[model samples]
Target chain A: MVQEDYILEAEKLYVSYNEIDIVRNVNFRIRKGEFLGIVGESGSGKTTLLRALMMLKRKNNDIKGNVRFQGRELIGLDEESLRRLRGMEISMIPQNAVTAMDGTKTISSLFHETICMHRDGKIRRRDSDKLASQIMEKMRLEDTGRILKAYPFELSGGMCQRVMIAAAMINNPKLMLGDEPTSALDVTSQLQVIQELELLKSNYQVSMIMISHNLGVISRIADTIAIMYGGRFVEYGSHEDIIRHAVHPYTKALLAAVPDADGKISKGLPGLPPTFEKEMKGCPFASRCEYCIPRCRKELPEDVAISLTHRVQCFRTKELQDDIA
Target chain B: MTLLKVENLTKRFKKNGETVTAVNEISFSVEAGECLGIVGESGCGKSTAANLISRLQREDEGNIFFEGRKINGGFRLKPVGRELQMIFQNPQDSFDPRDTVLQGIMQGALSYKVYSNRELKEKALDLFSYVGLKPEYQNKKTSELSGGECQRAAVARALICEPKLLICDEATSALDVLVQAQLIDLLKKLKNDKKMAMIFITHDLPLAAAFCDRIAVMHKGRIIEIGEARKVLKSPEQEETKKLIQAVLPVR
Candidate 1:
């Protein structure tokens, strides 16, 4: 595909906090209406990378790279331009619903504010209530009247999240960024939320970048997967490639650690990710990798393409694939 | 034999001049060395049942028998708290932020005969290793430990009194996958070695399938279905159970 085909693209993006690189040179592209899943352990810089792409970084961090949205340069864009791009063009759904929405405000008022922000007085105050209820009905929320009147704390966690998702879609953005959107919910509620997201993707044709720590969630939702470790994308490939034929040790270990639905427990990976307080050299996963060679500890590996879409950053990825085959 | 029996467990909370039933007439028994998982969504009353059984919250109507003896008021006092321990969803909340790991764990045995400082420290050290932590962690403050370490410390604290029944109220939900697996392994070891009965309350179906011998599916303050874990997951009769099973993203 040509570069113009991708709606969003990040090239050599790096984010540093107090001179410590949290997100290393990472690159990816999201084609129109495509869902890309980013999976990693906590502190793997998945959230940081997402924030950087959206230009939502806190003041303390220094971001270095290029982000293109709809063939336009996004990085180093002025705040006014970035603000115009956010929400109306690129929306976000946060992890915790209870904390994401204001507890003091009712769901209806929250929707009114969001709609008014993007609509720019085109949608009157009276119409917002009708629009909010219509959106709630679309989101499959029952008793829309009662739900709109209820405060975030008064409603259930699942309900609050559905409302949040509805609020994000009020502006009808082309892209959605969800960071652990369903992690706080129960299984049934999680299923409901996931279904709503899938419906939005299929019916509304909304492209999304979902960040999750759970491999199962990523596998179930994402068409393509990016496995991150420490501060880098160790492997990026199609969902089947990552799930059935992952070459990176971190990705392999992650898949192995998930318990089977048949009630069988897999061996847990030992050790934790290296703390990035100091400058990092060599492979970040070398300390925890089971098949680490001496070279892995001494040098950083380059990204090698197994296929057009499948890329791995490991010195021994070929050997690992050969052994697996 | 049943280590704990809960009969007609019911609890109601009165708020804003309206009474809402949290747990309604739920009955179950836990065999020694067995884990019974109560799987449900947030408002399903699973956590309420755990609280009522552990005597953290008073049940409006219920009979809780610990080894054939009924337990009532002042259950948090000696012998009762020691025999029936509960681990919360956020393990850090259960700990006193100002207390050291040794101090927090030794507090679990306060009901028993007074222990010398050295004896308490020795016991705490033993429990540290028992929950897969280094003995040196006993000296660390609760704030210094990571999420997994705090949870291990919480488990050690719960087991310090050598409880007959352990109630884990979504204890592993806040942990990572690897740490959660390690905690499950430790809990399994404790169940096998000590013959301790556990009530594992959680919202994750696949996790319950892996950890529990039997499962009770709860919905809106009712147990919609209860049976062997594998059987329930394989051929769920109740609509709630089917939905929950379908919701689980199958791992292999």
Candidate 2:
């Protein structure tokens, strides 16, 4: 696809704290209406990467890279200019809904504030409420009247999330960033949330970037899968390329570790996840990788395209692929 | 081979002055060295049932038998808590905030008087290895440990008593997939190697299918369907069972 066709594009993106880069040299491009799923465990810097995309870095961290949204550069944009892009153009659904929304305020007020922020005095409370309920109904949330009146804590975890998703749609954002959107839900509720997201993708021309620890969740939702480990994209490919033909040891190990629907389980990837305490070199997964050699520990491997879209960063990916085949 | 059996077990609580039948006439038997999974949504009385079985909360009605001995307020002989231990969903509440994880584990075993204080420390360390925790983590407080690490320590604490029957009340649900996988592998080992029986309670049917020998689907504080895990997964008898099996996002 051409550069203008991409909804969000990142080049050599780095989010650093105390001169220690947490998210290092990240690069990805999402075309319009495409979903990019980032799979990572906790501390993999997936959240940091998402925050950096919108100039929402923590007070101590500095985001260094080039990120273009609809051909408009995001980095170094003043807070006033960035505000215009955020919420209306680029929306986000946070990990925890209850914490993100005001607990004391009813769901309607939260929606009113969000809608009013982007539209200024051009929009009123009634219009925003109508828009919110319309989106909620589209998401198949019943009892809109009761839901709008209910406090954030009064709603269930899944309901709160659905409300957030609905609220995010009020401004009609081109890009939606979800961080572990359905992780807190039970199985049935999770299914509902996933279905709603799928519906949103089909019904609306919106591109999404969701980072979740659940491979199953990502596999079902995303068009492209990025397997992130130690703050780097260890593997990036189309859903088929990553799922059917996984090459990276971390990706394969991650795929193998979880219990399948049949209840089959692997020995699980051993060792604690890497703690990025200092500036270091080599693969982040080398310590836990079963096929790790001495060279693997000392040298950081660059991304090699095993296929047109499937990229892997591992010294032993070739041998691993051979063994798997 | 019946390890623990519950006959018409019922528990009730007054919520806002309204009586709630948390567990209504539940009956089941767990075999020695068997893992029986109780699957249900939140507030379906799975956790309440676990609490009653472990004697954390007394059942309102029905009988509980541990190794064929009827257990009640005056029950003796087997002493439920020692032989029948439980791991909760959040290990944060399971341990002492001030003490080391090793100290918390030793505390569980110290009451039984089977091991010396010095010997219990060594046993705790051994259990840590089994749970994939490093030896150095023994001194760290529960606050210092990660959620997975705290959970592993909780497993060690439960194992310190060397319980025959372990009731995990959505114990792995709070953890991420990789940690859950590792924890399940460790639990499976304990079940096989020590002939331990477990009552695995979780809302996820697919997860239960992976570990449990028998699966029981619960709805409205009652077991709607109970059968072999394979049978329940392949061909569920009840509508509730079908809903649960259908709800899981297809991975394969």
Clashing pairs in 2: A263-B210
Q: Which candidate has the highest DockQ of all?
A: 2
Error of 2 at A163 (Å): 0.8
lDDT tens per residue, model 2, B1-252: 898889999889998899999999999999999999999986789989988888778878999888898886543434667888888889988887998988988888787788888898888888887888888987888888878888888888888888999999889887878878888888888888898999999988988988899999999899999999988988899888889888876644
Which ten-residue region of model 1 chain B has the weakest summed lDDT? B72-81
lDDT of 1 by residue, B41-138 (tens): 78889998988887878888879888888885555545477888989888788899999988998877755756676787788888887888877777
What fraction of the genuine interface contacts, i.e. the true contacts, does candidate 2 reproduce?
Answer: 0.60
The runs of at least 3 residues in candidate 1 whose Cα sits more than 4 Å from the true structure, single-residue gaps closed, are B73-76, B111-113
- What TM-score would each prediction reach against the true structure? 0.95, 0.95
Chain A TM-score compared with the true chain A, each model in order:
0.97, 0.97
Poorest lDDT segment (10 consecutive residues) of candidate 1 chain A: A117-126
CAPRI level of candidate 1: medium
* Weakest 10 consecutive residues of candidate 2 chain A by summed lDDT: A256-265
